[model samples]
Target: MTSTVVEQLIVPIRRSVTRVFNYSRNVKGLKTHLEELSDAKTRVLHSVDEARNRSEDIEDDVGKWLASVNVITEEATRVFGDEDKANKRCFMGLFPNVTTRYKVSTKIESIAEEAVKISVRGKFDRVSYRPSRRGIEDRSHKHYEAFESRGPVLDEILEALKDDDVDLVGVYGMPGVGKTTLVKKVAGQVKAGKIFDVVVLAVVSQTPNLRKIQGEIADGPGLKLDAETDSGRADFLYERLKREPKVLVILDDIWERLELDDVGIPSGSDHRGCKILMTSRDRNVLSRGMVTKKVFWLQVLPENEAWNLFKKMAGDVVKYPDLQLVAVEVAKRCAGLPILIVTVARALKDGDLSEWKDALERLKRFDKDEMDSQVYSALELSYDSLKGEEIRSAFLLCQQYRVVER
Candidate 1:
C-alpha cells in the first residue's frame, strides 16, 4: 500500500513533466510563427486602410505576447530546475520531499498551459486587403451653398486639382470673403466626381491642434490610431497615406503655415496622387510657406452678384416698392463682400421700410474706410440686433482683436 501510494503521487509529477516539455515546444513554435509574421513582406495595403491598421495591431499583439511568453518560459525553467535539484538529491540518498516535487510540477503545468493558450491566441494564418472603390463621403456639403460669384474661383481650383504637377493649391482672400465656402464646395465636387480615393477636410483655426487635425484625417479612411505622441501620430499617418493611390486633403482656415512633416503629410513631390488644398485669409501664409504650386486669390462678389445674394437673403422684405431703392443702397454699401451682405440682409429680413431706411442711414455714417466701413457697419447692425447687453458687450470685446486673419 505504501509503494502504491508513492507511485500514485509520482504519476501527477510525471504527467506535469510531460506537459512542461510540450508547453516549451509549443511556445518555441509560436515564437517562431510570430517572428515569421512580423518579418513577412506584403503589398502596399493602400485601398483598405483597415488592413494596414490590422497588420500593425497584429504586430503589436505579437510583441506583447512574446514578452509574456518570456516570463512564462523563465518560470518554467525555474520549476524544471527545482525538479532537477530534487531528483539529484534523491539520487544522493537525500530522499527528496514528495510534496515539494508535486508542487513544482503543478507550477510548471500551470505556467505551460498559460503559455500554450497565449500561443494559440497569437496565431495568424493569412492577410488579405481589399481596396475601396468608392470615394469618401462628404457630410458637411449641405452646410455650404456655392455662391454665384465664386464660380470662376471654383473653376480655377478644379483646374489646379486636375494638374498633375500641382500638388499643393492655395486659396486666399479677406475674411468673410467665402474662403471656407469655396473650399467646402470644391471638396464636395471632388468627392462627388471621384477625383480621389479619399478626401479629408479639416479646419485648422487660429489655434492649431495637431491631434485634432490627425484625428480628422484618420476618420476619412477609418484608420484606428493608438499613437500617444504627436510624432507617433504623424508617423502612423504618413505610413497609411503613403499607401493610398489617391488622396485629397483639404485644410480650411489655416491662419499660418503648418509644417506638412509635422502633420505627417508627405510632400506633394514625394507622393504622386497626394494633393493638398489649403485656404487662408493671408496670401503671405500661402505664398511664403504653405502653397507649393500656385496661389489662387478669391475676390469679393461683383456688384450684380452681391445684390442678388442680398436680395435672396432679404426675401420679401426688400421686395416692397418703398424699400427697393433703400435696399439697393444698403446692398451696394456691402461692397461686394458676401458676409456683410448676408448679415445685413438677414438682419433686415423682418424689418419695415422705415427700418431699412434707418439701417441705410446708419451704414452711411461709417463711409470713412470704404470697405472697412461697410463691413464694420453691417456687422455692427447685426451686433445691435442682439437681445442682451451682455451679448453686445461680448461682441464688442471680440471685435477688439481680429482672430480671423484678414
Candidate 2:
C-alpha cells in the first residue's frame, strides 16, 4: 500500500518537473505560434482595407478577434524579457533556477495556446457587408404629378438628354409652376433607364451653400470630403466625378451664375460623359448665366388638365352637381398652376357651399394683380383654411426656407 501511494504521487511531481525542463521547447513553440498569428493578422488587415474601399462595414466577430490577437501578441512580447533570468544558474552557478524556469515556461505555454486559438478563430466566411445607400433612395421615391401640359416639356428634356452633342439642359419656369417636379421626374426616369451610371442632385437655392451642395453631390457616390477648404473639397470632388464614365448632375433652383469647377463639377467639355440638368426661375439664369446647350420652359397645366387634377385631389365631393359649378370656378381661379390647384383644391375639398364662395371671393380680390399675385393669394386662402396653428406655422417655415424654386 505504501509503494502504491508513492507511485501515484511520483507521476504528478514528475510531470510538473518535466514541464520546467522543457522550458526551451515551450519558448520556441511560443515563437512559432506568434509568427503564425502575425501572418493571419496581416491577411485580415488586407481584407479590411479592401472592404473599406468598397464602402463596407466590418463584422463584429472579426473586429473582436483582431483585438484579441493584438493583446495576445503584446503579452507574448513581454514573456521574452524573462528569458535570461529563467536560464540563470542558482546555488553558486552550479544548477538551473528551477522556480524561475517553471514560472516562465508555464506563462509561455499559456500564451502560445491563446495565440493558436485566436488564429483559428480569425478564419471567416465574410469580413464585411455593404452599408445602406443614402440620399439616392429619398430622391428615387419622391411623389411626382404626371401633368399632360408638362409631358411635351418632359419629352423635350429627355430628347435633349439623348442627344450626344447636347450635354447641358435647363428647365426654367415661374415659381409654383412645377419646375422642380418636372426635373425630378427626369431624374427618376434617367435613373430607372440607366441613362447614366451615376445620378446626383444638389439644391443651389437662391443663396448657394457651396459646401452643402458639394456634400449632397458627394453623398451619391459614397465620397467622404475631408478637405478643410472649399477649393480643396472642389478639387477632390472634381477628380472623383471625372472617374465616373457616365454621370448626371442636377443643380436645382440656381438663382445666379455658379462656377462649375468651383463647385467641383466637371463641365461637359471637360468630361464628355458628364451631363448637367439645371432649373431656375429665370430663363437668363440658364441661357446667359449657365450657358446651357438646350433650355426648355415648363408651362402651367392647361385649363382642362387643371380641372382634372383638381377633381382628383378634391375627391368625390366634386361629383355633386350642386358643388360642381362652384368647384369649376375655384379650379379656374388657380390659373392652371399645379401647386395652387392642388393646394386650393385640398383646402376646400370638404367645405360647404358658402366656404367655396368665400374662397372664390378672396381669389378674385387678388386677380386684379399679376399672375404672381394670384399664386400668393391662392396660397394665402389655403393657409387660412388650415385647421391648426402649428400646421400653419410649419408651412410658413417651409416657405421661408424653401430650397427649390417652388
Candidate 3:
C-alpha cells in the first residue's frame, strides 16, 4: 500500500514540474504568433492604403478586423512586458518565477490563439469598394425641356466632342439664350452615350474662383484635394485629369479668358484624352481669348420655335382665336430669347385679353437703342406682375448675384 501511494504521488509531481518548465517556451511561442499577426496587419494596412489612393471606401468587416488586430497587438506588448518582469522575479536570475510565469503564460496562450484566429479571418478577397458618384444624379439635365432648335446645337457639340482632334469647343450666345441649359443637356447626353469616360462640370460665371472651380472638378471624380493653395490644388487636379482615359470638362459661363493651367485643366498637347467645352456671351471670349479649335454660335430660337415655346409656357389661351394675333405679336416682341419667351408667356398666361394687350404695348415701348432692351423690358413686365415687394426684391437679388439660371 505504501509503495502504490508513493508511485501515484511521484506521477502527479512529475507532470506538474514538466508544465512549470514550459512557461518560458510558452512565452517565446507567443512572440512567434504575435509576429505572424503583425505580418497580417501589415498586409491589411497596405491594402487599405492602396484602396484609399483609388478613392474607394474600406469594407466594414475589413475595418473591424484592422481595429481588432491593433487591440491584439497592444495586448501582446503588455504580455511581453509582463514576461520580462516575471523573469526578473526568478531566484538569482537563474530560476523561473513559477506563479507569475504561469499567470502570464496562460494569458499569452489565450491571446495568441485569438491573434491567430483574427489573422486567418483577415484574408479578404477585397478590402474596399467603389462608392456611388454624386453630381450625376443631382445636377445632370435637371428641368431640361428639349426643343427642336436645341437638338441640332446639342448634336453639333456632341460631334465636336467625339472627334479625337478637337480638344477645345466653344458655345457662345447672348445671356438668357439658354447657354447653361444647353450645356447641361449636353452633359446628360455625353454620359448616356459614353462619349467620354467621365464628365466634370464647373460654372465660371462673370467672376471666377480658381479654388472653387478646382474643388468642383475634384468632386466629380471623387478626388479629395488636401492642398491648401490654389496652385497646389491645380497641380493635384492636373495630375488627376491626366489619368482619365477620356474626360469632358465643361467650363460654363466663362466671361473672359480663363487660364486653363490655373484651373488645372490638361488641354491641347498636354493630354489628348481631355477635352474642354466652354460657354460665354461674347464670341471673342471663346474665339480670341480661349483660342478654341471650333466655335459654335447658339442663336436665339427661330420664330416658329419661339412661338411654340411661348405657347407651351402661356398655355392654351395663346391658341384661342381672339388672343392668337395679339399673342403672336407678344411672342415676336420676345425676339426669340428663350428666357424672355418663358417669362412673358407665364406672366400673361392667366391674364385677361386687356392684360395681354397691355403687356404687348409695354414690351413695345422699351428703348430699342439700349443693349438687351427687349430682354430687360420682358423681365420688367414679369417683375411688375409679381404681387409683393418682397418677392420682387428676391427676384432682383437673384439677378444681382447672377444666380437666376437662364
In lDDT terms, which candidate is top? Answer: 2
Whole-model lDDT, model 1:
0.71
User: Clashing pairs in model 3?
Assistant: none
Please, what is the whole-model Cα lDDT of each candidate in the order they appear?
A: 0.71, 0.83, 0.82
Q: Candidate 2: which stretches are off by over 4 Å?
A: 1-142, 368-373, 382-385, 388-406
Report the lDDT of model 2 for residue 108.
91
TM-scores, each model vs. reference: 0.62, 0.69, 0.67
Task: Put down candidate 1 lDDT per residue, 1-406, tens digits, no spaces.
Answer: 9999999999977776665445445445544543443333111123124555554233455446556656765666666666554444355666554555556545655665676575565544433433442332345446455666678889999999989988999998877787877787787788778787778878898899999999988877878679899999999999899898888998888888799888888756679899999998788888887755789999978888898889998898777888999999999877677766776677678788778888777667666655466555554543665434543554464353244423
Ranking by lDDT: 2, 3, 1
By TM-score, the best candidate is 2
Candidate 3 residues 1-406, lDDT tens each? 9999999999977755655677778777778887888888898899999999887999999989989988988988888888675675666877778777667767777887898899889899999988967545246556677778788888899999989989999999877788878887787778877888878889898889998999888888778899999999999999989999999999999989999999899988899999999999889999999999889989988999999899999999987898999999899888778876876677678878888888778777768887666555554554666534543553464253233223
Q: In candidate 2, list every pair of residues with a backbone clash.
A: none
lDDT of 2 by residue, 280-338 (tens): 98899899999998999888788899999999988998888888888998898776777
TM-score winner between candidates 1 and 2:
2
Clash tally, candidates in order: 0, 0, 0
